[model samples]
Target: MTGSPTHEPWEVYALKYTRNDKPRRMDVMLGEGGSTDPMPMDYFIWVLCRGSRTVLVDLGFHAQVAARRNRVLLRTPLEALATMDLHPANIDDIVITHLHFDHAGGIDQFPDTPIHLQASEMAFATGACMAMPAIGGFYEEDDVKELVRKLFRGQLTLHEGDDVLEPGLSVHWIGGHTGGTQVIRVWTRRGWLVLASDASHYFVNVLQRRPFMWTYNVGDHLLGFERLLALADSTDHLIPGHDPLVMEQYPPPCADLQGIVARLDADPLFSVHDRIPVQAGR
Candidate 1:
């Protein structure tokens, strides 16, 4: 049976493993205090494309690391992928937004996949800041070790600047959240989807035109936000790195237990023009 070329859609799923201890005060990140409820850290793992070339964006936190660090894992990362009938081996390429433990810890789970990371991220993680007691706590030794091993083995693809991975997909180097943070832009049925992974942690971060402070250069953070917002056709087309409201807006998974996986080939039910009501300011 001769069928059309197998062009699969890009599917993004929220692999939420845990919530933050205190609802992260939205205003602190937005430079405004209008938001009341402390926002939960709803982590995610975005799966893109299909067939023999599946790309994964951010590999949620590892359960063991969370426990060892005395942090909570509301859900296991592996179990979250299982919801989509996927295993680590199923992934072909992994795009890491930054070297943060929450987003990079799961690389060990997918040993064979080639990882795409910005070159500067490696430098920042192992550089002078690591010695500082305040921010040192955020770096995961094991995760860095594994990534180093992969780098030496030539399993990691390090990009220095903006790069195109495919015809419809590209990576924009936005150094803010980290020295080498990046956001993924994909042309999907929903028009254009810009995964502002950590570039903008929450929707308000973009709306208020404020930036999170976990950055090397505050100026770069501001510029990155503007760059991402411009790349997006509209506000709705830009997906924040850790927004709880995302789960609420998108359709639930095919089954009730899983979050909806966005399909690149299918037209989005919603659009950037659609106005999502803003939560009342605190």
Candidate 2:
């Protein structure tokens, strides 16, 4: 569990949540001509462990926030972790994939755990871009305030560009969905795998060249997809941030917690549907 680049990959688990809500057509989530046949979306926060170091990715929105936003919250991310016997205190590092409310809401959950993120994201959250509704609409003011509080307490560890958190784990500043968005790359038993946080919320966002409408830079969003394809040992090794297929494709880590936790240390069971005719432009 020490570190791995080629062998002995870490255990990656996708703790998924059921977003029991209907999709609105023309919403930012839709692609240019995104299917009118109800878009399926789910929420998830990943957990990574290699021996002693346990890293949690993107703390999810709390129940109160869900209620306020009119979105269903089956279980808090912390509560979901409890089911797996992983308490918030046991998490060594908490990585903020982006500052969006859903991804960055649990600031208070992991007290004193050194947070990792791209520095530019902090700036985007606080800077004038927030004045623009199109850009700032996705973020909740309260979440940004809490992050600022953490910054003042000197509990946050910000990274610029790309950085290696440990021997086998690293983050790359992909900057697509958000100006400072980043994706996590880890060496797993399967090979090198990437948690494509918001870089590509769904597999189709990458494979079918469909872009999620709420992106900061369309060029960067498309580039992030290609980047994930290249960084991962294979296309099968890349995990999208919010795809429901993730749970259906990979078996749960244990029998009791079916569909709640997925093991990333093994090969994918389902074959990726290759409906898109064109190849990705590298």
Candidate 3:
């Protein structure tokens, strides 16, 4: 949304893979008003497609991981992609938003495809900070090891900072939830659309400038919200990584795809901001 694009815009899709229905508000936001009420969360992997080129965002975790984490595995990432006629072979590249298990657990699924990641993220996941259970608990050892294997196999692409993967598609580093969290920006028909993976887990996180409970650097996490706003066409154009509101705000590609895949390139059914609660004393 910041600049005019030289190439045709991409069509973005958010595919739901898993969910947690019992998560509490305290699990999502950090503040006095946070509640114990169910603050449901959804897991998703985004796709950016144009013509024959397809760019896959984070890979959703497998069912085994899902069961261990107590998340309801609706479908595997591979099955979700199949709905759109996409396969690993069809993906031009895979972008690992960060190395969290939910986002990088399936790295082995597409062993031959190139992976895009921020260098700092890899270091953070493997660095000494992981010795602390609170910090390392979110990452899976196998997933991290697979990434290191990718690096050695010459299948990984690490960006030092913001960089374009292709014309009209780029990645911007915005670490908050993790040391290497990055968001994907794609030129779309509506304007620049931001795929905010964990930078802001829910609309409330960004709309209210509240950090999620699991943050590596609270200050940077809050800063990521501002950066997301600057990159998106509007709040409606920014897609929260794990919000169920995404499935509701943006309609599916067709009637059959409802609740499973949302067409992010199209206008939302209504303004997404309207759905965010107006906190007391605001």
> What would the per-residue lDDT of candidate 1 be over residues 156-194, giving only the tens digit for each residue?
988888898876677889987777889998766555678
**Which wins on TM-score, candidate 1 or candidate 3?**
3
- Using lDDT as the measure, the top candidate is 3
lDDT, candidate 3, equals: 0.89
* TM, every model: 0.86, 0.92, 0.95
What is the C-alpha lDDT profile of model 3 across 92-207, one tens digit per residue?
89999998989997888897999999999999998998999899989999999899899999999999979988999889999989999999999999899999989989888888
Please tell me which predicted candidate would have the highest TM-score against the true structure. 3
lDDT of each: 0.73, 0.82, 0.89
Error of 2 at 194 (Å): 0.5
**Model 3 clash pairs?**
1-192
Poorest stretch of ten by lDDT in candidate 3: 273-282
After superposition, the stretches of candidate 1 with alpha carbons farther than 4 Å from their true spots are 1-9, 24-27, 33-36, 258-282
Q: What's model 1's lDDT at 188?
A: 61
